[model samples]
Target: MTRSEVPSGGPGADEYDVIVIGAGPVGENVAERAHASGLSALVVENELVGGECSYWACMPSKALLRPVTALADARRVAGAAQAVGGTLDASAVLERRDGFTGNWQDKGQVGWLESVGLDLLRGRARLDGPRRVVVETHDGTTRTLTARHAVAVCTGSRAALPGIPGIEDARPWTSRDATSAKEVPGRLAVVGGGVVGVEMATAWQALGSEVTLLVRGERLLPRMEPFAGELVAEALTAAGVAVRTGVSVEELNRPAADRPLTLSLSDGGRLECDEVLFATGRAPRTDDFGLETVGCEPGSWLSVDDTLRVTGVRGGWLYAVGDVNGRALLTHQGKYQARVAGAAIAARAAGVPLLETDRWGAHAATADHDAVPQVVFSDPEATSVGLTADEAERRGLRVRAVDVELGEVAGASLYADGYRGRARMVVDLDRGVVVGVTFVGAGVGELLHSATVAVAGEVPLERLWHAVPAYPTISEVWLRLLEAYRG
Candidate 1:
């Protein structure tokens, strides 16, 4: 065994079949799987049980944005706008968010864990060795835990603040502060045009904030296609968001209480705001976890193989799933990886030969490397799945694509008087599969699943034709996209 610095659970006295570090969705799923396999399991978490989505990421952002979307719809429809008076209740929106997230509680989640027979430890856990964990509890007690089967890490990610001069001194708000804020900033300067920044910008803008979005890239949603960016930019502009593209913030200076932020831009322009919100990226939380003692660095994530076992580490006992593994950052994908790791651990404990593949099997991280579906729930929501045209072409796929103005479809017209949306379908001509799908428009979230299923099932173009969209629905965009594919 490697000489380890991190401690374990009393030298096998409190050893379990499996010990899951981090009680986020992924870690919870891992413990659940171990219990289902008739193995004892324990899960440790230092923060709230539901992870970022519950409080700071997905849930709160959506709650904040929903009212604006609803208000916009009402305003567009003449009779509806007239009945609803003048505006949305910002206080009510915050209250609803607080109620759903349990005000950052793990009570219900802890109860559910107990009901499922998984032990819960409210503590910070670190790796002592390959199968050992030492936890420092919030109550000031240290407990060492050893896993007889496997030790899995599922700590999620944290917001990555950009490296701008004087940024830290300015005390900028990350997704953490922004999501759980008691008061929305009157004038917000959002640095980054990624999903989180854009969503927060939309929410605050709708909540009556004078929002200015600054991005280094020329277009919004650069991870997405240019067409999608164009559509979203148009929508954001229509919603009164000031978007400054191809610009970089050179410095951040804190001002007086009345005007808090001054951003010096590469364009030699200075923008002032009440607060600066950074939504650039996310880094995996692999630090201070004792990975170094086990031949892995704390800040660097563990590299895992097809079986989700860490590479360059012996005994095949250590595993990483979810954000900690640097795989797909989505909660669902992490849970999927946890299922694989959990099952693999159980099978190994039973002396069964490990099954391995990158598909949806018991040990595959296939979804991590493929078909990761993501959605942006802005006023004109955006949903995308699989690879893009450039990605497909780069992979040497003989590719063909089709783009359709969403208005061409009957569904778009029915959704609103002047519904402006765009849909693009990228096809792998050689494999006859839909490699990608992007939908950007109002009420487009519902339209994503069909495309996801098509991509996952690799349903052929001719076969997708049989999966007819309902008449006069926004989903008719799918039918139109398919027709454009052939044309």
Candidate 2:
């Protein structure tokens, strides 16, 4: 049946075996998994069905960056460098980004939801009580939905703007705006040195904007290894971005809509820019969702167990996945949690005992704690899996960190004229297994799954050595890292 013919959660169709709030990737996975497990499911979404990653955060942002990365890669090779053009075509890049987002339309996404046999409710959903949700539609109507088995919250998050004076009047850009803007600004000021800040700074600078990056911290990508941030900062600086650290916007003033913005810095400095983007952080989109009805604090992140079940909820009928639970904010990790939660809900409904105690079981989201992989798609990419060296040490585990330079690797040198990168592997001394690995360089994202496998599977160093990487490829970095660890 077409999406229009699907049930809209009215009257007799208001009840289902599972009701998933926020029809993003996480919610979609949960509903599909539950439905495939012989349970009826309904997904409620007030906005687009494909959610943030499809339209704003991941897809569009990547579309903007892909051209920049492609051009930079070409310039690194001698033969290709002579054939490349001077600068990117900003209009073409914007058009390509628009294509990725389907021009901000959700028709294709809605069709996919219909194909999966899940009912769609185009409305904002709120928790009415245990197992009950109230949805407000666009046309001044409300529908109450009751779940026979579970209610999963996957509302995700929104960009958080700082509480600077005149911030509201200044009209700063968020991640959404940075990715979806129709026209490029002449001068762009990017605040916060996290992934969004650096990535956008890279994209806009290459797209013809004079970009300035302001970071409150001492370095960028502070969550990763210190060297990762250092390398990325070096690259950004070389690319014409004014990278500033240990400073923040104290106030912003835009006298009028037609004029440039004047920003007052915390370090007694002033700057002017056509536009400013606040990439500081994200806040959970849990406010005004009627969470208080079920004793959950409104606007607070939900706490969950290994099974993705909300803690302290009496009946165990409530679950939260994705950014709302604050587990792992990445889209892929959220979908992983969705699958685990769906299985747990299905098992409980069918009177089958859940494998909550088993970390590797189908119903447990063990990777949320043990192995999480993330990549910062900067000029020189930074990717890591599992714990950092500092993180493992903080957990009281005796660990040794082995470092390798990518330029020393034959494969890396062959990939580019002057390949510059670094790799680190953190080994747990007691278990003789790999606990963490980080790679900072161009095209290192492709090597993350291998590191993830080693960390998550707790692969031993001896076993890893036998899994020899193919000769003269970036994967060979694994062999070098292992050799370094042995010595």
Candidate 3:
């Protein structure tokens, strides 16, 4: 067998052209890209192969939100609003969510891996050394595997809880627990007010939970445009959510006996809720990955360049993609980086000219730097692409922000009756090009990609005019934005 095909050592001694740690969507994409480029790949995964998105974060969360969003959309229409009475079918919502999550199984993902000539090792893998990985199989057996070309670390991040007294004992729900929860608590207390907090709050509140949203900042969605948070908070409050901002839980304790979770707030107050969620943030899943062997710190996000090759390594044999790299944490962005990293590895192995200088090359993850898009699937969904106006100003760019009331657009009225939203365009005035765009509405998530393409492609304002948006569609909001920008 070729060196690439030979196992490194042991009973299941098998080697590969590429060894990818973590079998999440990012890892799967990396393996697929490498295999498509004629490389033998092996994916090491301890949990499900499709990673957190397929079961927990993206898939299940979206599944839970879609029903609620649909109901909200229906309620917004005059004709449909009459028929929309009563809460969601919580049991059916859970069942549908389970189906979307594949019942927490990875059978389909495994079959796809095998079909693509990529092998799977059900184990937790650690870096033994450069281009070498040691995997502890499910049966407690250890196998040493080596990659001939590259070893990619696509292990994603995990939810990070805050440092609060008695918090551990409190058993607060993380994103995983929140997304996969079958039963919605009658009273839910969500902490952090970020994407997870808001989205889960929206989901459970619609699913019949008395949701109390706690935000340490003054507003929800602190990272997005300010108005986005304001509109969402307004809607959430209107929907009976107790939206409390500038708040933090001091101490949390779940009683040993059958009692609700008691939380001590920073304002010298107390809250007792059936369940609490800590949607604070995410930390890289590298605390035990043997990063020290490669002269890197364990438990920290790996550093990588535009090509996603782990920086400061002796050879470009190491790559850290997805959430592990800390470039862009979104699933789609991680998959994009995986594609770039995979193609780079394949080209490097074949001794071909790398697309080093090409801005939009297959090897470079440029979009990760310039054009990452995000959609918050809340009622009056918030979508943004590229840099926000604040981000542009922080970067010291000469940017002009054009704000337009989305309600002014005929399409917004037609999309759903009484649709109130805002759209903003951040323009690089010197370059006369769109640098960023943000939209807040009932169904603006689908409109984000066009903005992404506009910013990513660096399509000038003049050229974008020719790409006319269809009338009487939410997309025509683009024309209003352009008009606002021109003025």
Candidate 4:
């Protein structure tokens, strides 16, 4: 039972019923569920017990964006706009962000693990064989452990940079560097127009950075409604962000490690900037999980069934959840899969009859098929759940997409002086239920879960019509959308 000065979790035995690799939120939940089922569980982690979302990705990113969003909200109000002047206090904002991240500390997470009675082993874990894992401890000691029931792989992903010349040597910032950056760069060139790119661009621009957003796509937030990107780009341009669309990077040259690099673009353009950020995509962290030992590819995303149990293996003892499974990349979606996978593991261990996990079952990740929610916390805030009209049509569902300007909502005009936004509700004509919902505007994030409930519960349009919204709130937009659908 090796423990750190920072206090690690439980110490039951070298062997346990279940061993989860990568002590992220998903892994913790898996161990928790197994423990609740009277099965001894342990987690093997190489870094901080809390995963990327806790320290680097979600927590820090949201912390940095909150002040910017709040001030923007204040600026849009009539009386409140009078009090607002000048830019945000960068020092205060960074300090608050630091506090939110716990200064890269993991004591709180470690304490939570201890409370849950889940054992933690600080080591790099990999599969040795069926129901077996080999862990290399921090101090250069290797130990082999046996799992009686299941072994779950919750190792998430890392920022995947593009395969361009001089990209690696350029040492550009990824999401981790963007979230934990101590000082805002003077001139920042953001590559890729995904959530990380736009959100970080918004944050740094607000915190006093000359931002150049380079997007290979035709517009920003390409995954959302087209107008969502149009509105966000308008707001960003108004705020003085250089949003260059339909552009590609030809090459990057940084002569000095500490100095700005000259950016070469495919459009015969050049810009020198203090920092460059690559928010391109993510790659699974399965390169060294010893998947080869179990006849699985080491560096590839693990394939899993509805229950999150690894499919290609001989026995169903191996499971992959979260980003590693390549299902959905969002933290909330990963956590959702974690809950379902954990319940499945517990049921299989106790020899109890597993619940029907076909679509929306106890052990199934049905939301991954549809009803996945996402929010990009840029200036105007774009949020959505389930499918868009195009997506429903692609899946062969006869659907009607009803669109309405958010300013028409009584609460939106009352909330902000000039609230420029849009809302779309995709209704399945055959099913008479809302299949997808999208909202873009100030404070639309709060209205997202209501849509999630509607889509996940398959709530009929008739039922939703009776759910009266408050007198003056953004939620009143739902009434307008439903009315548009009826018309």
Candidate 5:
């Protein structure tokens, strides 16, 4: 039946097998998976159905960075360097980014929901009680929704601004403003050194902004290997970004909306910029929405089991997926959780037992712990899968780390002249299998999946040695790492 023809609960209410709050990618996946399992589903969204990734975070940011990366790649090659003449056309780049975001429209996403036989409700949803939700629609009307089987919360997260004095009045930019701004600031000061800070610094600097990157920590991208941050910092410096470390904003001052911002640094230094971005961190978007009514904290990240069912909630009928649950906040991982949660919900409703204890079970999101792959799209891209060497050591695993320079590899040299990159493979000594892998360089993002497979599949060293990498490719780094491990 068409979504419109679906039977309603009553005059001002509706009922479905699954009610997914937040029509972002995670929620959409949950509803689709549940529907595919023969359960009726309804999705409620307050903003665009595609959420932050489509409008402000992933798609638009990547769209803005691709041109910068392409130009940098061409300039690295000899013949191509001669052909490259001018700076990037900022206007054209912005237009391309706009195209990727579909100008912030969600019609296409809404249609996809209908095609998949999932109903859409445009409103802000709050948990009323077990299996019950109250929605505040844009038109100021209220409607109650009841889930017969499960209620999934996929509300995701929002940018968290720090509590520095005067920060509230300074009107600084969050990640959303950084990616979706209509006009680029002449002088941009970025606070924080995580993925968001570095990526936005790279994009805005290339797009004609004099970017000053301020990091409260000792180095940038501190979550990765030290060398990863070192290489990216070196590249950003060469590209004219003023990378500052061991500093933070003590205070901020702006006399008027048109005036530039004055920042007081903890290091007893003062600076002025046309704009400042606080990419400090993200907080779960669970401030309201009546979580307290369901015995969950109003603004706390939801804790969930492997099957994505919320812990401590009475009936195990409430699930939390995506950033709201704070498990590997990447989009792909959240969708993975969504699929697992949907299937588990459907199986439980049908009185079917789940392989809950099995790590590799179809309804378990085991990859969230053992193997999570991530790529930082900055120049000298950083990618890693599974555990970091430090992480493995902290977990008390007996492991050996093997390192290789990408410039020494034939394929890497051919890929770019004087290719400056590093690769590290951490092998679990007891199991003789790869537990972690890190690659930092230009175009290394594409090489991540092989490492992901190796770590996740627990492929042994001997077996990996026979899995030959094709000649003249970055994949050769795998062979070098293995040989180094043997030596």
Candidate 6:
């Protein structure tokens, strides 16, 4: 471990080179970067070390859904039947999920921290002031740590429940509850047709819960192309997921007896379920972290400059990454931000002038602010990158779009005998470069990285045309998209 020679204490301080708050993927990357650069770093975390992705949001939800997706694929084959002699075991899945998440234990993660020489402070941390963090440990002692170089916040996000009548007092499940539950609800009503809600609904539906997905919008996944939403709706309907788009849950009522829950809708219909899961959206975890002491406020996220520096902090000693910055809430994007901020901090500390990259440079999180890629790991999955046509037009770009039935592609044909899918690509007419791409069908996740690279690299359509997608693969949609653009 590298030692700092000038370890002088300041206000309510214990000496450290860097102090990282939150032990999520982003925070872990920040600590690892700091330690790798020969700086003493301490990580303060209140929950499991691997963060929400490990236990609730990403990992467990995928655990619940993966088997369903696999089963769907298997059922497509001859003589490979599903849900006949075999059904999804919710308890076994949850048990396997717990094992994957290490049952909320930090021993394995703490071992990694120790290997990297990072001081592990297992507690909830609040920003006392600039360069000062106060942690109240589970053991009941409070300790203050002063950071010499920087204090980086990477605390992830939490499920945000939109204000509805009786929602606050009503017992409900969020992504956390839906993913961690050992038993599937008898009948589940998912409020919100976004990624998390749609995924959990499918999982529970496969696990023998009659699932209903309610959405206020006219279609599901309003964030993606309308065609993609149509595909998802079709898949959900086929799998017995009762999708209620263009409806609002006006009131949530509790029952004293059987089933226990019911929803009154604006459309004069009621949905009864054993449990309800809310996947309205996620909000940054910035409330109790004392952001005001550093000139930031609650409800608003931390303001960061191109270099990932907290805009108003003194001596360039404060940084914020991940969901707390209110950029991309995905775990991988957060880790990307942490890498940039960590490297920038280390370079600044060593008196080395930082070399900068473009919008995707170290520290900017430019991609998060603009073209972030997202994937929904559902049956007939959807993947997207960059700005859609509507967004481009709103941003004053003269955009041209090509929409193709995914079934037209050779790749879709290979995936299934009766493959149904949709594909769309948005192009910047002025620059003749691909700006956005969306693919919805079976096995589409494998196609997103190419789209990401195109958007990030600004690869021109002519050049991209020459970049051949592998034959007998779902990725041949790229060729179809480019040809449509050419015509």
Count steric clashes of candidate 6: 0
Candidates ranked by lDDT, best first? 2, 5, 4, 3, 6, 1
Task: List clashing residue pairs in candidate 3.
Answer: 7-13, 7-14, 7-15
TM-score of 3: 0.97
* Model 1 quality (TM-score): 0.94
- 10 residues in a row with least lDDT, candidate 5: 1-10
Better of 1 and 2 by lDDT: 2
Clashes per candidate, residues 3 or more apart or on different chains: 4, 0, 3, 0, 0, 0
Instruction: List model 1 lDDT by residue over 58-156, tens digit each.
Output: 788888888888877766665776778666677888898887788887677777787787877777888887788988987787887778888888888
Q: What local lDDT does model 5 show for residue 336?
A: 84
Tally clashing residue pairs in candidate 1: 4
Top-TM-score structure, candidate number? 2
- Model 3's alpha-carbon lDDT is 0.89
Worst 10 residues of 3 by lDDT: 1-10
Question: lDDT at 102 for candidate 3?
Answer: 85
Which window of 10 residues has the lowest lDDT sum in candidate 6?
A: 1-10
**TM-score (C-alpha, index-matched) for candidate 4:** 0.97
How well does candidate 4 score on lDDT at residue 467? 92
Q: Model 2 residue 393 lDDT?
A: 97
Q: Which parts of model 6 have CA positions greater than 4 angstroms off? A: 1-13, 79-86, 255-259
For candidate 4, the 10 contiguous residues with the lowest summed lDDT are 1-10
Q: Clashing residue pairs in candidate 2, if any?
A: none
Tens digit of per-residue lDDT, candidate 6, span 287-306: 88888787778656777876
Residue-level lDDT tens digits of model 5 in 1-487: 2353233335734878899999889999999999999998888889998988899999999999999999999988999999997999999999999999999998788878888888887788899999999988776778888899999999999999999988988999999999999888999999999999999999999999999999999998887888889999999999999999999999999999899999999999998999999999999999977989889999999999999999999998999999999988899889889889988998998999995648878888999999999999999899988888998999999989899999999998988888999999999999999999999999999999999999989998999999999998999999999999999
Give the residue spans of candidate 2 off by over 4 A: 4-11
